[model samples]
Structure formats: structure tokens, C-alpha cells
Target: MLLPLSMLIVAPVWADEHPGQAQLVQEVAKDTGKDPAALNALLDGAKKQQSILDAISRPAEAKPWSEYRPIFITPARIDEGIRFYRDHRALLEKIGAQYGVAPEYIVAILGVETFYGRNTGNYKVLDALVTLGLYYPPRATFFRGELKTLLELPDNMLAGPLDTLTGSYAGAQGWGQFMPDSIRDYGVDEDGDGRIDLQNSLPDIFASVANYFAKHGWVKGGPVAARAQPDAAAKPLTVKDSAPQWPVEQLEAWGYGPLQHLDPGALSSMQTFQGASGSEYWFTFQNFYVITRYNRSPMYAMAVHQLAQAIAEGVNSPESATQ
Candidate 1:
């Protein structure tokens, strides 16, 4: 998930001197074939952004589903989401057909992440990566790997210069807010321009998002989820893993079922959530689990699901909305 970086605090402690710079110089310079001194100098300009450390400690994902629901599932966001879906009808449908992911889920993802390209932050990507990579030892190895991949990206692919590049404090960027490695692996030239520009390219962004979900095992023309009710004889759910682990028959045997019939042996999971609307029970299909791959939180998944449902219900002929 993308963390907004509008409130970043610039700290300069690590800019002038970081003992680890020497090792970084040797490692990155060796990989990139650039001069070690140049690499070191670039890092010397990277400040240890204290805000990044502070921000990571309190991510939006940490909030309970009750509070988190209103943040993304608002009228303004939903209205804007409908407009975005209407504007990009054929394109979203085309890619949706290609990737097996529904359009609304893709649109909901964009809506939740940056309000459809309106708020991709202003933090320098280099500083964010460096600050998190060197000083934040908990995830330093991961951030350092992200930093290495960011350095490897071509200038054409970046939103701006490495030193002045702007993105999330965690270093994800562009319309989809992809991490550096995600861009490298899932990024595609949907426009066939021989370059993938996530910043300005809508086709690339749509395809990239679709590619991400597809790679994570999104099922085409399959179920996503359904509201469930426990029968009078229902037993306590023993399933532990978050994803779809038990068969529909097993869940049914325990006295849970959807309003409509499902393949008795199909894989799914029973989820009990304490949301803004109070406790709700659901049977999530495999595709719902795929949405969680984009953001691991169940709240995120539920918001996406409900938003997509709202969009889908509104999109008949009178209006359009992506899920």
C-alpha cells in the first residue's frame, strides 16, 4: 500500500556522513558500473528523513477497519471514481478482459491510492529510500534493496531526477504507487512506445495494475465474495490462515452459506470483520485474496470490495464505476 508523503520532515543528520556509504558505494557502483565516488557523493546528498521513520511506524493500514472505512469510502472519492471509470470505459474493460481482473477493483485501487493521480507525494525518492535503507534497521535490508532497484531504473522511467524524485516516503511512486521493484517486474509499455512511463502513461498504468493482480493469481470470471449468515446450528470457524483455505462444502457443513449456491468444494474463507457498520461476516473468494496482495490489510480489501460493489451497482447504463 502507498503511504501519503505530504507531511514529511527533512532531517539532515545522515547527509554529511554515514559510515555505511563506503560499502554502499562499492556495492552499487560495482552493480551500475558508475564511479564509486559519484555514487558516494549521491548518497552524501541523501538526508536521513526522520519523517519517513515516523510515518512508517503509523501507517494507515494499522487503523481498525471501523475507522479506516470512512477514509477511502467517501462520497467525493466514489463520485470521482465513477467519473474516472466513465472516462476510461473501453480501456479498463479491454485490460480487464485481458488480465481476468474486473475493472472496478482496478479503479478502486487507484481511488484508494492517490485519488486517481491527484496526490502522488513530493518526497524526494532518493532521500526516502536512503533514510529508510540505512538508518531504519528493521526494514533496512528491504529498503536498501528498493534503493538498489530505484538506482537501476532508467531516467525515462522515473517521475524526476533521482536526487529530486518525488514519491511516497517509502519510495513507491506513479499512478499505481508501485515500489521500485514492482515497476521493474510488472511495468509494461502498453502504449508500445518502447518505454514504460508510469507517471504520464495511462495505458501503462492500467496494464501494469492488471499485470500485478494477474501475477498474484487473480481469477477471471470467478467469484470475489458474498455476504454470509451463520445458521442456527453453525459451529465456530476453525480456519486460521487469512486467505481462502477451506472448501465451500466445509464452510457449509459448519452452517455458513451465501444467498446463492456455490460450488460445494470451491475454495473460500470465512471472514468476520468489525467494520464501521458493526460486525459483518463474509465468504471471500480467491479473487478477494488477490486484492489483498496489493495491500495486505483486510480493511483495504473490504473497502475495495464495497467500493467496487457500489461502482458496479451504479454503472449499469445510467452511470459507470470501476470496482
Candidate 2:
């Protein structure tokens, strides 16, 4: 879900004139009562721009199943996944059962975001947020708000200003890729140690992730999506900005039928993805939409869904006993 901010730097804009930058400093001072002098000093010499502008400005890679599939469901990833599950099976199972989110889905998220704790970013979160908030005009307002929230974070939760400045290029830090606001709001002290250290604690990371999904209205035992067939007479459904709409009965009335059995009252949204066999269709439900909230891409959501299913199924397979 992290969009590269380097793409926005080449638009001939200067960092000093953003209205939100001043507002953010004021808001931070007002909200956290922190001495702005220290923060100002920190910001004064920070890099004003990213050097990766040309790298980010390139057109986004379209839905390339062949290319994207390997990133999430590789054999090595799956193997490491098995170990992750075994190591944290107790906590993961408890959280998954409580949140109605599959442990595999949570594992896939960790895998996707940080390679299961192997590559948790090298940029300081403070510097990244400050740079993007002041210079990235296309999303300056959003990043500015995040920067204000970052400043308001408890000192105990933060890396020293320098350490926080070096984590993710866009300011998302920790194992779950939480922005500072999300960290403050959704983090949980799963270890019962009175602290939530997402960067190094697996228990805290998994629990925080479950807490996030629960807050986002993840339904227990709800269907994420199902394959379906649309009648030739049915008018094509237009996908606008990846929002899910339409119920099962309405879709049927419009010439869509479930490829697998589905209840008439089930909520659904028509979704199409390019596959090697051609275009594939599915009726996505609320849980699927929840996945999109984590990353606003259907491909990303679908990848998580499929990888989760694969991991769960692989664990339960008869051949799994031999391993």
C-alpha cells in the first residue's frame, strides 16, 4: 500500500511554501505540548527531497499476474511461512480466532510488508514523513497530517529522532507497516509487558494486526469472495476505484451467477482479474473490501487472499505430515 513518494519531487515545487507544514508544527505543539524548538532543529537540516524521483515517476506496473504472483507465494516464502506459523502458532491461532481473520492472511501481510521480519526498512521514519509532508505536494496534506501525528507519539514509543528518521522512506515503520497514528491507535501489548514494540516483538506485531482488522469491521467467518459467472445478456459492471457494491440477488438479476454455491442474500461485488486463462470473475464481499483498506489494490488483496488460502491448505495437506 506504500506508494513511493519519490515520484512527486520533480514537479518543480519547493518544500518551504506548503501551508500544511506550518499548520502541522502548530498542531503538534498544541496537541503534544512538545518543545517545537527541538523538532524545528531536527527538521532544519533534514533532506528536503528524495533522490529516487525518476525511479518512482515511471508508470506503475499494470496487473501482471505472472510477475506479482511470485512476490507473495514463492516456495521460499511459503517455507519461511511454515516456520513463522509454527513459532507463533499459539498467539496467531488465538488472535485469528478472536478477530475472524485467518492466521495465514496475517502471515501473508507480514511476509509482504517486511519479508517476515527480515527487511524492515532502513530509512528514519521522522525524516521520511517530514520530507514527504513538506515536499510531496500531490499528497502533502495527507503526509502533513501523519507528520503531526508522528510528533504527538509518546516518546517511549519512538526511536530516537534519528532512528525514527531512518526507517521507511514514506514514514511507515515497524513490522506491520503502521504509520505513527495507526501505531498509537491500534498497537497492542500482546506480551503483557506493558509495552508494544512492533519492531522487534512478534507477539505485539501479530496482535496489533488483529486489532487493526477488528477495528476495521472484519466479519468472523464471512466469505471474502467467490468465483462467479455472468450471463452473456448481463450488462458489464463498471469497476470504479475498487469499491465493492451489489448484492448476490441483484447480481443474479443482472445475469451473474455464482460459479460455486452462494446464498441468495450474500453481499457481493463483481470483480474481474486478468489470468493466464483469460479474464476471471469473482463476487467480492465485505471481507474482501477490508483487505483493500490495507492496500488499495485488488491485485494486492487477491494475492493476500490466495496466499493465505495456499498456506492454510498446504498446512492441512496430507503431504504436510512428511515434512
Candidate 3:
């Protein structure tokens, strides 16, 4: 359920409360045709959340792959993803087919993002955006743009009343944890109910995720990532170079051969992780980069890939069939 809007900031505030707030109000009003008074009321109701600032300063993506992988790829998470897939199999499969994305990858996104919606977030969307947009100097310009976008977005694209909407510290909302721009660009109303309710509607949630991937060039039935057996003289790669720029043949010539049979001409890149056994290397493909578009971290994409693989395996196992 949505929490009540903070009453503390409900009192009317003028443009003088924060720097450039007046310009924001005027711009949003002109751009979106929203009532300036209502916009003021909404903006006044937003309280600065220091937690959001602190949270963004230390994102999970900052961690090494070994540490980051354990946070999302666990037995319980995989089990829950499998159950979610089974329960929503038909819809998942349909949406996956429509968008050319695999169902387990969709499920893995939900698992990693919000544990299948069990924890969409506790921060109010307004507070998260406002605090970061106005106070957080590092990315204030970006977050401010998001704050304006949130105000400008149509009601049909939102999950609920703007005052009560809750999401992550970074201002990402609903099941898929989309930011304001992502919602505007990629949100789907798969049920055709007029409103794109990412919170309660499974079709909207599933389809929105798939649509984002498809628009971002997720190849149908394409390989995501493959473990590579690096020869004694393999070239090293920093995490920064994870984009699929080189062909698999080029990587092979550098002593990084994929454990699986990937097309020699396929574009790929290498990512080295600090795993339990020591430094681990993997050849990442186009779909792997597509996953990174959701969260720009090689470790994040790897975790999703491994988790999706686990869930797909569980779905196909005889044990799952008996249940």
C-alpha cells in the first residue's frame, strides 16, 4: 500500500524555498500544462531525504563482482524467481515472445530489482527526486531533469497518486524500478487499460521490461555471456571495457576462448571478475550489454545472467515438473 504523503511539507511553499524552484515550476507548467498551483503544492510536499543522497553515493554497483554477485544470485532468489516464472508462465512467455526477450531474464530483473515486488521501495518518489535533484550536487542536473519529467508525465503513465508514489532512493519506481525518463520512453500498457500501472498490473510490468530490452537491441535467442578459458598469456581487461566491441575471433586470438560454442564472428568483450577461486574471465555478448543498459555494471549484468540461467534450469528440471 502507498504511504500517506508527508504532512510536514504540505503547507504552501513559494518559489523562494529553493534555488531555481520558480523556474522549474514555470517550465513544468508551460511544458506539461499542469496547474502551477498544483505543481507548487506537490513540490512543497516534497521533503529532502538525506538517505537518498547517502544511498546514491555508495551504490551496490561500486562493489567487486564477487561481492556483488552474492547479493543478487542466491538460492532463495533463484527459487523465488522460478516460482514467479511458474505462476506467471503464460504471461511471461507471451510478453517474452512479443518482445524477443527470454522470460527468465525478465524474472531475474524483478528478482534483482525488488525481489518480485516484495520491496518496491520505501522512499516517496517526490522526496527522492526532490532531494537528489536539488541538493545532491554531483548529479543535480540529471536528477533535476527527472524531477521535471516526473511532474510532466501524464497520469496514465504513473502507478498511483504522485504524492503517495514510492520507489528506490534513486527515484526509480514500481516493479521494474524505472527512472522518470525510462517510464516516459519505455513504459507499456500491455493490458490496454489506459493507465500503465507498473505496481499492480502484471502485464504492464512484464511488457514494460521486455519492451525496454527490445528497444535497446536485445537479440532474439542470442547468447548473453559465456565463460571463457583464458590461455596462459591472455590479455587483461578492465571493467570499463565491457562493451561488445570486438568479435569473438579477436578475443580468441588474444587467448580468451569461450567455453560454449559462440559464433566466431559474433561481437563480444571480456570482463574479469574477482571470484572465489581467483580472477575469473568471461566473454560478454550483445545481450549482456543490453542487460547493462538496465544497470551499467558488468557485475550486475553477470548476476542477472547467472540468476536467469539458474531459474531457467529450475523451470526445466524434473523437480519443478513434479511440483
Q: CA lDDT of each candidate?
A: 0.81, 0.73, 0.89
Q: Please provide, for model 3 over 1-323, each residue's C-alpha lDDT reduced to its tens digit, 9 standing for 90 to 100.
A: 65334423333334577867888999999998899999988988888865667779899988887788889989999999999999999999999999999999999999999999999998899988888888898999999999999999999999998999999989999989999999999999999999998899999999999999999999999999898999999876554656788899998998997887889999888888898788888888889999999998888889989999999999999999888
lDDT of 1 by residue, 138-216 (tens): 9999998998888777766665566876788798888888999998888888998887777788999999999999999
* Alpha-carbon RMSD of each model: 3.7, 4.3, 3.1
Q: What TM-score does each of the candidates earn?
A: 0.90, 0.86, 0.94
The predicted structure with the larger lDDT, 1 or 3, is 3
Estimate the TM-score for candidate 1. 0.90
Instruction: Sort the predicted structures by lDDT, highest score first.
Output: 3, 1, 2
Q: Per-residue lDDT tens digits of candidate 2, residues 75-178?
A: 87777777777677788999898777778878988887787888778765665776677767777778878877877887556534443445556777777788
| Candidate 3 local lDDT, residue 317 | 97
Candidate 1 clashing pairs, residues 3+ apart or interchain: 104-322, 104-323, 105-323, 308-323
Best by lDDT: 3
Model 3 clashing residue pairs (backbone): none
Error of 3 at 214 (Å): 0.2
Ranking by TM-score: 3, 1, 2
